[model samples]
Target: MNDSFTLGFGGGGFEAALRNWEPIISQTISFVPTLEGGLKGGMNQREIDRGVDGFKQLIESYFSNVALSENRFTRAVRFK
Candidate 1:
């Protein structure tokens, strides 16, 4: 699991890497509940849904920052 998370974080460059992080995190979170009673005996639907929603917010914030950084870089290059 750690390896998978690390790979997802460093796999693709920039945009691609950010995109990959979403699913990897989601899958990892979803799997946690299954360790007790197989595939269908863990966390409730509400908990899973909340986890997914939280992930979406985190991804959005990351992408927003990436976009802002890219815009600043572009502006700097243009001014130079």
Candidate 2:
């Protein structure tokens, strides 16, 4: 019974890790464009708008991922 519980918990944790990686992966992918936008000048309206959109998206995506990852990791650690 104890072994079964341990295995179940471990499996769940592993599954969660796999599930959680996607947003992080996505944000990582999104990072390059965001950084590029930051590094370059945005003197024009369109360029400035692009930079703002990029920043907003990055922050939204990243913070959401952060919240989810933190919750999951915390729960996992607490479970253990």
- Which stretches in model 2 have alpha-carbon errors above 4 Å? 1-42, 68-80
- lDDT string, candidate 1, 26-57, tens digits: 64454344343322437667656666566566
Q: Write the per-residue lDDT of candidate 2 for residues 22-78, one digit (tens) a residue.
A: 555665665656545544564666666677788677767765767456665344433
Which pairs clash (backbone N, Cα, C closer than 3 Å) in model 1? none
Candidate 1 runs further than 4 Å off = 1-41, 67-80
Best by lDDT: 2
**lDDT, each prediction:** 0.47, 0.57
